[model samples]
Target: MYAGCFLVLSLISFTIQTETAVYIQHRMGWNKAYCMLYFTHGSWSLLWPMQLLILRLQKWNVPWQPFWRRHVAILRSTAQMIQHRTLHLTPRQSQQSPLRYMIWTTAYVTCALTVAGGSWYVAVDMTTASDLTAIYNCSAFFAYVFSIPLLHEKVRFGKVLAVAVAIAGVLVVAYGGKAEESTPKHGGKSGGGAGGPDHDAKEPQNRALGNIVIGIGSVLYGFYEVLYKKVACPPDGCSPGRGMLFANTFGSMIGFFTLCVLWIPLPILHFTGLEKFELPTGDTAKMLLVSVLANATFSGSFLILISLTSPVLSSVAALLTIFIVALVDVMLPGDLATPLSGNAIAGGCLIIAAFIMLSVATYREMDEERRQKEMEVAESEVDEDEA
Candidate 1:
């Protein structure tokens, strides 16, 4: 039940993020509000909400332990029980393997760092929120690539080809959307005009940069997904939930550090004697507040969704974001519409098709496993009864 809710919430969060990004671009002209919001509020708001959810589970009697503890307990007990029934084994045989733990811990930390750093970098570099959101939609490509080797999972050749087709589609969408240049408008001298009042607004340059940064970030994020699945639980005895909790906690910490470092360079580079930092206007503050809340919801739900579903599913659901954003854009007056080209439509369909194939494969695998388990139990029962 929780998993189902998490998946639904995750889908909703992506949709909301798309809508919010569009709103920010339409209202704030991409430069002033979008970049700042991504740097400051994006990770911070997400941390607390997710933390609260994890803590709530604990309060409701969920057992939480470090990866080592739970796995060691299982290995120790299994070895002891086996030894009692047969020949006694050496102390080393009874103990949990340290090398395996070390390898997994390293992978987890590396994944966390990559994801946190990439997220921060993209947020800092991306000029427009829509481009950032769109780039993230391509994360499924990375997820599929990493899943095979990292998670020891096999995908069908058809599904692989479908994913490739989806990538082609994404390329089409990225190339089709062209940005236009506009002059930056300044509102009197009440607030700081750090870039100067007449700083020419180069929308095309910013959009292109934003798209590139976001696309790279999505790839890095996909690698993180594989790391999480592999190290999240060990057969020797770690709980997947506990591993996820630690990784997320550590990832959030890294995000905070990255945010601070990114912001440090920006403040120092402010134009001299143009306009110093001032309190935000009433409307700006209100907008920031709403964005923060929406961002938090999106972030918290995303983590929960990832925990509940595979990275591929999460990635597929994210593809829906573009459609949601399109709806929002059409409803709003004076918003620019990038005409749907043949490539864009084809890419969208390919992505959707890939997701369907992946889902069918997953379901088939699960059913087969369940049947095998049942057969094993039935065979054991028959042998016992005959004896």
Candidate 2:
């Protein structure tokens, strides 16, 4: 039953997020800065505290007073821990400072920039859903690469296999050969427009550029995830729940700050005629509303996933999105040319198979470790009795 619910929610979040990204970029014409501002500043992001609070009270039956108190204590503890050299900024034991705080906050800023910037590029440059998704999903590869050196985690055969297979799948989906041209879902014209063949000729170049941009964004975000483990988690002083609570609050505060600081750029850009800023309206407004709601749900679901499963598994679960997004693009049209290429299907299958292999390996290893620990404890007890 849990598995079923997990799948359903995962599918919903991935589908909505993919479509929202595509639609916003291809059709919305909203600037990246404005998009980030709207998302983070004095808006839904600021309300994360209240949103998380309500979730806590409703789902865990946690008392409001206790929850509030725990949040306060955790914030205090995390600060002291950081100040006292108890918790470093990263696995390298780098010291924390106001500068580091600003740097980490860039994770949030960069996150916004990547999503909005990448979407813009994809909308204007990329030709298919497979291309957009294939590039976006490369973050899993980035995560694995970063994890080994930065986190100093042990390398396992199964994990290596999983990563290899998943990456291979992405390559297949992307390069497996183009599908027959059909009506673009979001109405990107290739064969027509004022420029004619000269315009059409640029499509391949633009798409290659977009793919590169997306890949870079994927690398940054993969590091962001590792940073969360290495630097973002408060410390051993706070319980997992409490750590998460203040982390959410801390992020909201950062978002609020970003909202204010970001205003400096929009007017400059607008006046300079670099990128025009406009409030979303009409279909754009409606689309944003849906995206925000979907994002909120995704965030909440992600939080739940972390509690229920390891972050690594959670990431694998997200990898499934690339497959779903491409499939959706094929089955349902929001905007894009032919998405269901033969290569994409075969690639998606490989990715899914990789995820399953990883899951089995992870669980099996965990169980073995648990049993080993139990045996050691039992042996120690028997020795004590004989004495």
Candidate 3:
């Protein structure tokens, strides 16, 4: 039941976030990751509070009065912990709103999306949009590796095989899925070149570099995801509703850092002629406004999935976005559409098969766990009657 709910929600959220961001960068003329990061991070700030307030109305534990105060304290403590390399949680603190949990959320926002999101948008400039998304999702295998030790999810053959399958699929999509329309030969008179951003990004070398950077971002994001499961949404007593509220609130806080740190570097980079850091204006700003809203909901929904399901499931679920985004890019009336390739189709199939395999393995574990609990309950009843 939990898995089903999570799967559906994850699919929607991942699709919305990936497709919107790619569309803005790849299709529309707005490709500033710095601007995108501010909006993306701010989206959480926009969303989590409203959801928390809703929970409060429903009688869930929503800290109202001093919550913002504690939020500030958490930020300061996290900064201190970073500087001193000293952070610990007491047993009681472990159960409540701990600085560790908030810290991890900030780390995820900065490391995963802020960093990864930036790389991903830049990647869009170089590679085909679909290919960029597909390759970046190769993070599933990275998450799988970290899950074993961090999540204590047992290493099983089926799960391992699934990871291998998905990785192969992503590679196939990245390299051989060469859309007929992707190269000049496939260019249509409709003026939809599919590599629409800047003409220079269409270079083969730039595509290669984009792929490398996106892949690196994926690895780091995978780490962020597994740690989120293990640290933020522990299986002991946390619920999706509760974790969503806290995780997202902490995530929103990262926007503050982005506002501060990313701001300073923009002028430095601009003045030094390193990279152009232009603020969004007009249509670019409008697109960012809409995209960030999607991002906020995306973060909220993603955390809910992680809390209800495993990190591996959440990661694998994102693979579906590649197919969905690719289809949209191809079908939509725009130059951003890369021609759909046979290899990409094959890759998508392989990835879907991998998802099924992982699902089956997870179900088997759940069955065994259910049986063990039932047996324990029965034995306890027997002892009670015997007494």
Which predicted model would earn the best TM-score? 3
Between candidates 1 and 3, which one is better according to TM-score? 3
Clashing pairs in 3: none
Q: List residue ranges in candidate 2 displaced over 4 A.
A: 1-10, 24-47, 52-67, 74-135, 179-201, 204-212, 234-247, 250-254, 303-312, 330-341, 372-387
Cα RMSD to the true fold for all candidates: 9.0, 6.9, 6.7
Model 1 poorest 10 in a row by lDDT: 185-194
Give the local distance difference test score of model 3: 0.60
Top-lDDT candidate index: 3
- For residue 315, model 2's alpha carbon misses the true position, in angstroms, by 3.3
**In candidate 2, what are the lDDT values of residues 32-112, reduced to their tens digit?**
534433462334254456756676867587777887687665555564453443653453333333445645554564454
Better of 2 and 3 by TM-score: 3
Ranking by TM-score: 3, 2, 1
Please, what are the lDDT tens digits per residue for candidate 1 over residues 316-366?
Answer: 655544444444444555545434445445656765676667667666776
Clashes of each: 2, 4, 0
lDDT of 3 by residue, 98-142 (tens): 455455556554655556555654565566654564566667888
